[model samples]
Target: MAEVRAEMVANVWKVVVNEGDQVSDGDTLVILESMKMEIPVISEDDGVVAQLKVAEGDVIQEGDLIAVIE
Candidate 1:
């Protein structure tokens, strides 16, 4: 399993993948808003999305685990 973490502090602007979705290494999992910019959170390893720990509008800190892949 792999844990998807936030790269920086931001608000979850969108969730592009749902639980059970298959992903590739560079697949976009979520989009975050910070400093008026959108940032995409991507999977580090190919796997099925096992959990989504964040939602749209949720604020997250850097290094916070946002999703689980397995």
Candidate 2:
């Protein structure tokens, strides 16, 4: 399994993938808004999305768990 994490403090702007969705490396799982900028959180592994740890409008800290790929 692979864990995707937040790299900065931000509010989740959108979620692009759902649990059980197939994902490729570099696929965007969520978009984040911080300092008025939109940032995409990309998947680092190709696998099924096992968990979504965030949602739109959620405020996340740096290093927070974003998703799990299995």
TM-score on alpha carbons, each prediction: 0.94, 0.97
> Model 2 over residues 27-65: C-alpha lDDT tens digits?
999999999999999998999999999989999999999
Model 1, residue 7: distance off in Å is: 1.8
- Please list the residue runs of candidate 2 whose C-alpha ends up more than 4 Å from where it truly belongs after superposition: none
Worst 10 residues of 1 by lDDT: 38-47
Error of 2 at 40 (Å): 0.4
Which candidate number maximizes TM-score? 2
Cα lDDT computed for each candidate against the true fold = 0.94, 0.95
Residue 2 C-alpha lDDT in model 2: 93
**Model 1: lDDT to the true structure:** 0.94
